[model samples]
Target: MRGSPPCGTAVGCMLLLLLLDALLLFAGQAAGEGIITNHVVVRLHESAHDDAHQLAVEHGFQSVRKLPFGEGPLPLLPPMSPRREANAVPRKRQRLQKDSRVMSVLEQPGFSRQKRGYRDLNEMEVNISDPLFNKQWYLVNTGQADGTPGLDLNVAEAWGLGYTGRGVTIAIMDDGIDYLHPDLASNYNADASYDFSSNDPYPFPRYTDDWFNSHGTRCAGEVSAAANNNICGVGVAYNSKVAGIRMLDQPFMTDIIEASSISHMPQVIDIYSASWGPTDDGRTVDGPRELTLQAMADGVNKGRGGKGSIYVWASGDGGSYDDCNCDGYASSMWTISINSAINDGRTALYDESCSSTLASTFSNGRKRNPEAGVATTDLYGNCTLRHSGTSAAAPEAAGVFALALEANPDLTWRDMQHLSVLTSKRNQLHDEVHQWRRNGVGLEFNHLFGYGVLDAGGMVKMSHEWKTVPERFHCVAGSIQDNHKIQSGGRLVLTIDTDACQGKDNFVRYLEHVQAVVTVNASRRGDLNINMTSPMGTKSILLSRRPRDDDAKVGFDKWPFMTTHTWGEDPRGTWVMEVGFQGPEAQRGVLKEWTLMLHGTQSAPYIDQVVRDYQSKLAMSKKEELEEELDEAVERSLKSLLSKNN
Candidate 1:
């Protein structure tokens, strides 16, 4: 009788009982599976001004605070006294619901904050036993180490699809890898590894007090560190075989050493990951010498039983001032240059902006948190979280390439680059300096991010059904031999008009990579900036001003400054190159010669189809946007009409 609703008639009693039942149902739902607090959020009607306080007082609430949220809900807090019971918040919510002034009441359920883990259930299927697996944010960003959620290589999804680089082999061309390390020993390919420094079969890193020679080992771990072994951490392709090519440990880097290292066991190795380059001091302009160039050419032509060997190079860590085009290795059209992004989707501080960079991967950012850097195996069976820079970025890309190779082994090196351009994602990747722009074929690219970050899952998926690209051919489009003087504070603009060798044996219809090979001398080389504009109106900054370069005597000589910005664009029109000076003190320069190099296939049917698909998608997106605008306008008009009628 005490709990029964008080009413004058049976119908009134039934209505009261229904209202009580509704309140109890809401209370039960709000209290389900959550910690109950002694507070209730109450939303007052628009006409009930200052009634929230009165209602709280009547409901025995000790204090009320306006919630800075939608509709200005007020949270009523009960006093912490012996009279308070566990159901105080729910009882207050029920009593407030009975007030005509109150529009709605809800018990404020308490929820604890938690770090984001695996976003997808499939991510947990790969049982990684390594202790530092959680710290490998680049592999699977779970919002760990202050990284953004879903900003990663997406390797887990690829692994979930049963591609783990089982048949692929990657070679780490660095100082030397500790092949004897516990995490790498099982995956080490002895037949493919050799020490160009020591000229021995064993490619073990030399002993060092500061672990300076551990660079190759760390890079190797990034590609094929053993998984489920409780070692350092999992690799991007944990089942891939890794070979160490010790070439950077010697006192001097020779053409033979670099050549041998690059071409080492090419038939056995699927991908070659090179992180070292010319000194990133923003002044040095260097690349593969004669023999090394030949070796790279041979590898691409004859490697993988003529399928072509994949070459992955680090773009550089010369920061904003230094352009990666200054480094010939990264700017090389034969190599797939990779840049680095931080965990927060920002361009890394040490990243070099270059148009030739093919893609991007994650590296350690400016954050000094304990788990901020890459987790990989170090020397003497140790693990490290200090691997940073574009040096660390290249190996991650190589590992992703290994995954793709395992998915489809017949893919050629050029095919790998094609897949990279088609499959890499622009997932939250942004550069504060350079904005993303679409090419003629509707592919987006950035100087800092290239074609965007390498997507392991996407690449693997695309590789499984990919067809080998058409035969690649190079055509020297145009050449200018006249000396053009660039006065102090003045710029020199040159234009080249050609048909891109139409009807020739080596004709290029659809562009792949463009190079502006120039021989120039300047009073201050660092002050010079170079840019190239495609026929399709896409501009690529071939070289940025390098402040640290003080080499006034020796300027660029036959330097091949390359760009991938004009990929898939028609090359049968005029091309523009702008050579300008930007520095505190004006400097004089002269462009003695410039040659335009175009490398691409004569015909690519896929590119045309890609453009059509993009156009269709763009049309659909515009249509949807117009429909949304119309719907919004109609709703606004209806709201106005209803208000006038009321």
Candidate 2:
């Protein structure tokens, strides 16, 4: 109304009001029209319309909103938005971890399997810690009370040179171990535990827990148990601290690898322990997932107690048919020193089954291997059980690292790896190993057994005495198991409690469309998986991750996976461990008995750590001696007083 009274102005105002009313009328037309019989498509200002009405073409906005923009969701089909549960995923086909439940795709068909009897035929009863002796004499002459052909004199040299694990920190990435197990209690740090498997903030298992495989427990015992108290046996390293990290559960390799790389619930606990790889032709160049490699690098860079971490890996249990070119995981790299089982010689004359000797055999292509052996450890509730494979060897090496770290304090994982390599001497050490073994069917560093055997004492002293790591021949064997190593390959014999193989009852039924929950301990790394050597009719299939679906990444708040199986090959019952891979593109491997190994590793240190704490031989109370002296003094005073008074 420019001038307030123009006739044109009044007419224009009326026209504008009319236009607004028309728009509103159009927007609500559907409400009264029963429905559009001819569906008209109109262009309108998005902001001006309620999924309807149209405005002038000059409006500065986008097109109209879709019909029913603000209407309540249609009554039936799942509400506009739906909620979901969480779960986990796999990373490979053959990497197995602690507690996991899923088989790998590699377990498909006709894949080559690695299996063989483990016999440390050349394993010897040797102790290479003598103060007096030509270090080299151990190779040709018998050792000090240890029946070996020669001594790993280098052990003494290292001791003389002054090297003990002082600044090193080893992370025991395996199953949940009994931090308080008498056999492995002392060496554990007061605060060291985390269940990467279940995402439980506290890694401790139940108070009265039984070991799944004992592989971890045995390994721990060998690594460090307070030495000298004499409750059980001595550890390779006399004084060293060890830690544990559980990250598996008979699940899938994908589950294991993801757990290892946890960043939320988020588990990110890192520890160096025995794990990784399968006896798959001994290919040291296994194509692991990216996260596993990153995790390893991170561990070394972020060591325990600030010194850095040392990870010890067991090469594999597939001896007889191993090919150096395909050595599986952890052992696949130079950073990881592969371990082979040796007859450290500390064994009962008979095994739990009352068998004269403990061993397992296998058929590798055209040969029959019978030289199987068992690693040593404190007796689990059940006497001595046969533990087979390189699975046992990795823990042995880890134990020595614990001892060395207890002394030196600055040795890094690299240092430990270097020491291992510098000591191996192909042929020269083969003879020494034979001497240590009393000469059984000992082969050089063939694909079957990696680089022969491990020497705890020899490794302990190497840091100071030797300038470079040994290559195939460790100097001294420190104190070792003395028992034979376990090698498998006969028929797949699955034993649980005391139940024999039940074709129709237990395992047979489980193999039919099974859904297992595998829990993996944080011990081994790289891609995880399992290769079930069973019938073909049945197969394992990955279902949607469930119950808890938070994140989709490898490691997160929600990544537990569930798999369903149909029919598989005809074999034994459930395997002691599952077979799988870390991911869709990973290699197959045997699940690591991280929990059993954790406890076993602690056994030796538990006994030895206590022993080293003492200085006197009797192990009696020093306080008791002082109390006796006081009594005698009192008696003398009374006699003197009586004489004076008389």
Candidate 3:
């Protein structure tokens, strides 16, 4: 009914009307949301540069900035009052759409970023009154003390989620604790504490001139120092209860003391943290005595109302020259051996490397800086930042375990180990001497770092929904009685092919731990190195060369060198063992006996699900790669077409 106004042809008039309609629609949508910004994006024809300035001025817009892409979208600001800006977009769009120099016009939409509903340790709101809390870099590392940022235990997120290790008790089995200290007084569990050294109920530390008896107190503070009391740094599990067993203050450590200390209050105590072990001199090979071994077996079998009491042992501070497997406590199946990592996520100089270490925590390391040491409560109601060594690492792990216990108290000792293997993070941890390797089922592990650093937040969250693992069983896979000789520079290799005791009551389907008991003697004990390869192709260095050991006469006697490297792997087929020497000169050795022991569950449905999930992830990864390649190919094709047309 209406005649064409400016354009002569009806098609041209229709195109103009359609463009104005599209621009009006865009402006309407922006105004409907009340998102009236001062700037607008525009696109101009290649030949319109000279007239762009004049055209922009006529539409109440001034050119401001050019986007990154060449001849791409340009930003223009409307020289108008904010009150008038709301109605300016539609008018400017109409005028710009009708101009010959302009190709298109669009109103800029308002956008704002927001924090995600889920939070990590770094993002959570934590209010603590302790003055030294910020200096505890291992708990909440924010690039303080010249350390790497975000390399911490991730405990804040767990605390925000209301898991503070409440209703759980961690016993410090060391010298003794200063329970009277303000920071530790409120959380001390006296009913479960005893001084085996004095054979009395008061487990207070025996004071001396040197204050050397502060080990137990410092370790206790790492686990359960009271929070918000304006004292020292807050503990990892600040709401948990701490008990001190004063046994290491004696003149000599006896089997009875060791047994009684390990078995004390097993029903009430959720975790027993032992920071002391054998001499760790790289020469001595010692372990729990007969009575202590019996007590440990009882603790795991009947402790915690049959859920099993958690025993956390420090992997020795024997340096690279010593292997922690020699300290039988760290390598035992009943204990969780924790190693140490520095503030920079590197292995500490004094950290002992072994296959038995389940996980790691922070320690003072070899750094000479005073702030680099672990900050905790000291003796005589004081505070210190000089606590160091694997002793500092074990208590941190015990605290993390306590957090998991508070989240789910039904977790067993073995369940805790499983959680450690599953939830621990490899976060920037590196070892120059040993490389990280994946196990048969793709679990990453290092001889020094074990599975990885303990992750408190991940462990606590997973523990909330964790189901108990299947009943554990043991199988004597194979036994080799024939004696073999090892030449100076050569190696002794033995192979045992078996079905892992199939069709028996003690059959093992999925492996948890493997022990290779060997009776061998060498001319130079320090040069002996032993390795075992599982049927699934995972090779575990059961025993590494300890350079400081000069004991040539008493070479290992029926020593059960254990390894957790074969965890979650199938135990079928043939297993291989290699024994050799590494030294300046060739050393002779003899292999008297070799016995393979397998411990695991007969059926683990969760492991099966894990394998399936891993496969699905692999498939999804491959699909994503293919899609990315196709996208790149299409982009290249489109660019080529545009170039040809130009």
Between candidates 2 and 3, the one scoring higher on lDDT is 3
lDDT of 2 at 77: 12
Which 10-residue window in model 2 sums to the lowest lDDT? Answer: 351-360
**Candidate 2 residue lDDT tens string, 1-646:** 4667533665456544554454444434423433212111232233424332122122112233344544421111111122222111121122221113211111111123433322121243333332221111222223322223322222333334344333333445555555555645766653555567666645444333555635455555545544444344434453556555555444555634543632221112223665554324322324345676565555555655433455555544433223222332442232353434223222211101100001111101111222223323433422122444445445545555555555454565445544443333332222221222211112123222233334445455444333321111111101112221122221112212211133222223111112222232211222333222123222222211111112222221111121111211222322232333232232222222211010001112112332233233233443455445445544555566567769
In model 1, how large is the Cα lDDT of residue 440? Answer: 78
lDDT of 1 by residue, 1-646 (tens): 6765569666567545554555555455544667667656677887785776776677787777876776555555554443356777666677778889988877766777755533742346667778999889898887888888789999988999998999899999998888889999999999998988999988888888998999999999999999999888988999999999998887788888889889888889899999989999888988889999999999999999999888999999989878899887899888999999999899988999988998999899578887899999999999999999999999999999999988988889988898889888899888899999998778899988999999999888778767777888899999998999998766799999989999989999988999999999999999888988888899999888899898888898999999998888998899999998988897898899999999999888366554345436655765566556556655665576568769
Where does model 2 exceed 4 Å of error? 1-168, 201-211, 255-271, 276-287, 301-308, 324-328, 344-375, 378-385, 425-462, 465-646
> Quick one: best TM-score, which candidate?
3
lDDT of 1 at 382: 95
Write one digit per residue (lDDT tens) for candidate 3, span 1-646.
3764787776557545655555555545544664567667777887876666677677766554667775554646455445365666777778878988778787776666656422343454888769888888888887666677777788887898998989999999999999999999999999999999999989999889999899999999999988899999999999999998999997899999999999999999999999999998888899999999999999999999999989999999999889999998999999999999998888888999999998999998355777988999999899999988999999999999999999999999999999899988888788989999999899999989999999999898878767788999999899997778888768888999979888999999999989999998888888899999999999999888888888779888888899998899999999999999988887887889899999999998357554345436656765566556545655665566568769
| TM-score per candidate | 0.77, 0.39, 0.81
User: lDDT score of model 1?
Assistant: 0.86
Clash total of candidate 2? 203
Give Cα distance to truth, residue 606, candidate 1, Å: 1.8
